[model samples]
Target: MPEIPNEQKKAKMPKSVPFIIGNEAAERFSFYAIRAIMPTFLVAQFFNPAHNPALQSIAEARANELSHLFVFFAYFMPLVGGIVADWFFGKYKVILYVSILYAIGNLVLSLSTHDLSLFSTGLIVIAIAAGGIKSCVSANVGDQFDKSNLELMSKVYGWFYFSINSGSVLSTLLIPIIYKKYGPELAFGIPGILMCLATLIFWLGRHRYVKVPPTGVKKENFMRISLYALKKAFLYAWKKVFFNRQDKTVWETVAEKYSPEAIDGVQAVYRILAVFAFTPIFWALWDQNLSEWVLQATKLDLHIFGYEFLPEQIQTFNPLFLISLIPVFTYGLFPLIEKTGIKVTPLRKIGAGLFLTILSFIIIAFLQEKIDQGGRPTVWWQILAYFILAGAEVLVSITCLEYAYTQSPKSMKSTMTALYLLGISLGNIFTSLVNNSIANNGFFARYTGASYFWLFISILSGFFLLYLLVAKRLPEKSYVE
Candidate 1:
């Protein structure tokens, strides 16, 4: 292939790139718009007016917890959707179908604030759609480029992530304005419109996408083969090694199929499964930003430019911080580290990111302790937390996206991306579990809110450190350019 000039490469993006990015921009706008207002909306819509004054606080707490739980599940549904896409439909088909479902979810949400049951159901559908679409879209971007132009793939993903943050920032700002001024109906309705636009954007690029076919029976056969080998190995270990049976048939069969030479597939499975074990801790910390952290902010002194900020607006800083820092880290810090011969492998970056997460929580914990002691924490405290968290996100999330796409086998690319997302899903489930535990007033009752949060962060950081130690030994793989 002839070398394409830098200017031409800049001007001539892949055909499908615009549509995919456009879709993401609109979809994120819709999703974040709803998410930004959900907690406040739930409090206003679900808390019982007729309740006793004493129980109102409890009722509001329950409402907030339930709303965050809903958000958690919404974030998680991609795991199932991703599996389905890998096993059944191609990524394109899955995305198209799920985008419609996402639109319906928005519509359902827009239609009613009075019916809590219906609203919850709508949110569930949205989660399913979002999950289904999330894994496929990034993988699809990789599909657009082959070996000839693969080096540009990372740049494409960077742009993709940039678009996501950009959309999120806009929606974060607009959703609050809509919620505070126009009310829930308009606030919810606007997102629904944006979702529809996102669907249309996706459809417009149908022919441009380099669609990959589903794996179908080949994937099933591979799984079956792996399972059979594993079973034989276990049986042989029991009979020959332990029981000292005369039968060596199982041992022979296991060696023939699952010997060290043929274990890559099995090793991949084990490694992927192992990563999931610690994923939920990440999610638990992530969910706090929207639920607990925002709630905590309401109690702080947030007088900025003579305006008392809404709790939800605190989230805007996360994306703002991300946008500002991406350029600085990409051009400045990364180059300095490279020049100094400091290695910045994905695993190391993730470990560093995990450590940063601990710092973010420590900042939060300190602020909370001060607030508990009758001191008003500054808005800059929240800004600082967002700054640290955003840095961690850049290291972990962007690198993970690259890792998931490249490490996966050609046929299972979407599946690998889905597994990557499953971490977030498990994280959400973890949040739900924690929230439920706290609500029950059993084991966690001894700790105050800040202490409870600090404990969770400390535990997560420890788990993340362990994960990095183990993952460090695993050999890296990259099939994509």
Candidate 2:
């Protein structure tokens, strides 16, 4: 029994994809437009008092910490978002409602540009809205296609990602220039206006969408069953370890009450979640594009033939590479590889992605050595790393969305997507610990700062090996339809 039909396995993209694509471009523009200038704005505008130097130092460090905290909250909120959408409000209602919150949050940001308290409040509001809508919007995109259209789901997501980069490309590059030119109010205000338009674009297509209402499943049921299964599995394993393995019937009666299909679904959800746990490390590495990479480039050469480039401008190359390379990988390279009689299963691509990430960091490690030794490293090294990291993203990040949507039971699609986001939250937490360790001159920062880069490269390599072992032992059929 194949999960997808063979006849329609080849992609034939749908018509409604454009609406979602357009909406996503606008929404991402809103997101990145503000995010593009946020850290600098926090330090320069929000943290700067009438003209106090000591307060300025504190504000800069606080701004950095707050930025990471904002990201952590944004990812963590998906837990609430997924559950609420899955059990209470449907995806459509939640997306529409939370999008309003998103709009309001941006408006608050625009208004509070000079006021610290209100600006902080605005960011928290945006985090709430971002978390709430994160899982549902991607799930909503999946809902547009049916089982017959499953093959095209991957293709559609490719373009969905394409739209994301398209939006981010412009926002990341254009908005910061605005902030530098006009000031914070107009910079934030522009994104707010885009957010309002984003809401309208989504609203306009309300009638054309395929809405998946909540399955009417209670959160209690999932929690209660999860506890039951864990306790039982632990007890049964203990009985086998300390006692005889001959009497399986002792546990049989306890498991008999649940339907076999229900148990299978539960197990599937658990397995998918375990895989998601791998994602945060990937994101911890991926997110550096917006943070560490930009800061680090300021230490390098940005002048090309007398055309001065801002360190922030270095960030634009990510989206440029993303937009250019995604089509090559999705439409050209992957299909060509498939024709060579190789199976590029989702899990395998994930494993491949982790290794590519390791390679990217290894380059960073080498460059860090150059910087530490008072040698000037070329900006090209960072671009090479970006190219490798971008490839890793196509392999891991894009595939995760498609995998999370297709593998989960219809009732739990959003929930599974939220669980995937949990990895990113965890990854940020891990990243903070790493940063703190390096900052405090603690155990992880053994050599120069170069050790920090090597540490992540080593960690990701180990993770990839573990993935291969666990994947080889598991039944592949358990994951797909």
Candidate 3:
């Protein structure tokens, strides 16, 4: 008799799931711990004392630029990581190797509190270390399920995200306080220790994992097709412009050289990339939670329940709210929406997130106006912004994580995930450039104070419209089955 089809097989959780989730939790704790303290630490250690009333704006601006640049590099390096994992090392080996670098980077940071060059070198290494494995980890989680239990994949991703925020909530709340009472050394050291633990946790699951071997450097690989397509386009352009010859289109030229499957794979990558193109603005607004939002909190009155909260600590709300919001949306909100005879698709969720992000920034702009006019606002206003932003994040970030994996072709999963992450990298780099411009008195520097928030709101609104246009025509293909 023919064996049962995998889809008809019972859904079962993989034994390796716990290890991935646990490793993610510890790893996120390490990342967020240092991130929570970075803005204030930069000002304290590099520019001027954190508390000095002189050149405060300069110090804050410098902090924002450096912090955003760091985040940019962290997100950007995933492209290299994805390429390395998908083409040569495989996910398990790449993650294990870079994780060692990750631990060392944190140790370097912990020891270099007094030396700017040492700190900068350490930050670059950490960026490479963290980003190098970022795509592999999540993609690896998806690798654990086959068509036999593909139905369980979404739930696993939810828990995966839940663990990430759980770690974030703890670190964001605790680390800044450590930085305050103790010093940067211990605050940074703890994350290094946690990273080593994260590595150990991952290693323990080695035998249980469903390891996907690297595809090696095949001619039909996505990277090869992409590179060939580029070369063809360049030659085509050169011929068209100089030789006054127009024969075949770029696609025609590419098709001449690559297989149909390879060409289709590259086209799929382009389509997914098109969807991702609109997302950088969302990230530009989202990552501000760590940089600009923290600065805004510093200007507010942070005392509550007889304890003064650090401005950096206030960002704890994003992850804190996320820990609660994930389940509510997964079990409560999504199911409730579907019951109304409406299908809750990924694009719909992302649209809702984009709209909510607009609302959050509007609220932030209003609060900033009050502050710009010399009125001290309550911490609660920013808290509200954080809550709404958290809701947007639940809808966008979590959905993208699941959607990217489910939609990617098997050969291109890590590459697609890396592209999704590149949006964050681009967003942060955009943010860094904007802040750098403002610091150096470049164009649009006059849009300061509440106007700065308005500028982002305007950009996000325009992009949301563009997203709607593209999303409607975007094709969906699932490779998981």
Candidate 4:
């Protein structure tokens, strides 16, 4: 390992830190630029002539469904990207190469705005590229620090997240302006420029990064272990639930061979799997902030200084709120808790975050009730929801990142990051399912719009809380960093 000079060690982070920061900043700008406007753009820019005209009742519904489908696949592609990065290209090279694809995806999106088929293809490509880069960049951040500087890693993550939000703030604020003033062309084109810049910035830091070579055995071992554990756990749980109940003799024999202590390790694996299961519900809510939520905002009364706001501008609140809250929670809230001798574990924070998510939707559901009661809701209601949701994000998202990195086998770090991303991907898929249910069912159907939508989320979140409580008692020491 390379030793840092004493003088340099005590100083602020090196040029590589800023380089990584800059890369992340630009990458986020690109992502949010397209994401902020995607829902609206789907309705306006990529309307299918066969499905009536854009914004017509039927067309609007179809467009929303299609937009969600795009979102689902965009998230799903990270699994493929993570696999490629872990098995073939190293994280650095994979990020660099996929970034180019990212840039191209944006360019294609810009050019294909009016052509539905081409536009959809462009969006798919962009999702693949985005998914590819998402894990790589995050894992790269972990690569920047090691055992000695690991204490500073939290601060580094804070800064990285800060850059992400700063870039998101800019993109959210500007992309809408560009769409309103210039058109979709400029709106999408600017992100391409930023993405190219991000790629260049990452490349510049190549030599400074902690370049861990791919361990050929690790990937194979992970697959074998994960599969074997999953299979055994399912069989054991099944036997306990069914066969053991009917035959006491069989139960005792099985218990003797695979005692509770023997199966504790399998339970731990199941617990981790359980975490992945319920986590997508949260993502369903998170990803929709840019899509369904923006659409809802358009229907609400929004004003600032007597000027009505654009829907896309409302998307800015998430990142803006994140940027402001990060320091407050990290510096102020964390220290206050520490001073009081209250230990804050990631799992506890995640549970609290999950509960907070329930509150966020409850707020939205309440606002929808007001709207349904013939009173137009205030935009401030949406703002409040964003504030609560942002808090949940800080608790769940940040903790998940740190937890995933720490809990992963050292050789499988990038794969773990990909797994975390997969949780979000699955969340989007859940969102799609929800969206599809709403669309296919009548607007007045039991599960349409806010009433049905929020009720479902509340149930899912409640289930997640229950699972967390049950899994909470499992020993986590095996995976702790």
The C-alpha TM-scores of every prediction are 0.84, 0.80, 0.86, 0.80
**lDDT values for all models:** 0.75, 0.76, 0.87, 0.72
What tens digits encode model 4's per-residue C-alpha lDDT throughout 1-481?
8997664666345446888889999998898788888887776655533535332333444455666666676666777766677667777888888888988888888898788888888888888788777766777787777655667788888899889888888888888988999988888888888988988888888888776555443423445554655565667678878877433343344444454443343334444555656577788777777776777776689897698889889878887788788889899987899799988887777887888788878887787777657677878888998998899999888887777655544544555556677778777776666555555665423554566557657676777767677756744544563
* Of candidates 4 and 2, the better by lDDT: 2
1-481: candidate 1 lDDT, tens digit per residue: 8998665564446789889989999998998887788766776567654645554334445555675566666656666666666668988999998899899999999997779889888887887787668767877888898755777788888889888988888988888888889888899999999999999999999999988887664423346666776787688768876778756565356555454433554445455555445555766686677766766776688887788887778899988887888789889988899899997777777777777888898899989888778788887888789899899888777777666656656555545565666677667666666555555664654445578678877798789768867975766666567
Candidate 4 clashing pairs, residues 3+ apart or interchain: none
Candidate 2 lDDT, tens digit per residue, 1-481?
7587666577556666777888788888988776667766776675664547545434444454456666777899888888788778888888888989999999999999778898988988887788888877777888898766787788888788778878888888888778778888898999888888888888888888888888776633556667777777777778888885745443353456665555656666776777776888888777766766665675687776677666667778887877677789988988998999998788888889898888988888898789868787888898899888888888998888778877766655656767778778777767756655544556654533577577777787887888888876544333444
Q: Top model by TM-score, which number?
A: 3
Lowest lDDT block of 10, candidate 2: 472-481
- Note the residue pairs that clash in candidate 3: none
TM-score quality measure for candidate 3: 0.86
Candidate 3 lDDT, tens digit per residue, 1-481?
A: 9999866778899999999999999999999998898887887788777577655666666778888888998999989998889779999999999999999998999999999889988888998889998978988998999877888999999899889878988999999888888999999999999999999999999999999999877778776777888888899889988999998887888888777777777877887776677788899999988988888887898986778889998998887787778889999999999999989998899999999999999998999999988888888889999999999999998888778777776666666777888899999989888878876778856667788889999999999998888888988877677
lDDT of 4: 0.72
Error of 4 at 358 (Å): 1.9
Clashes of each: 1, 0, 0, 0
- TM for candidate 1 is 0.84
Specify the highest-lDDT model's number: 3
Model 3, residue 75: displacement in angstroms?
1.3
Error of 2 at 325 (Å): 2.8
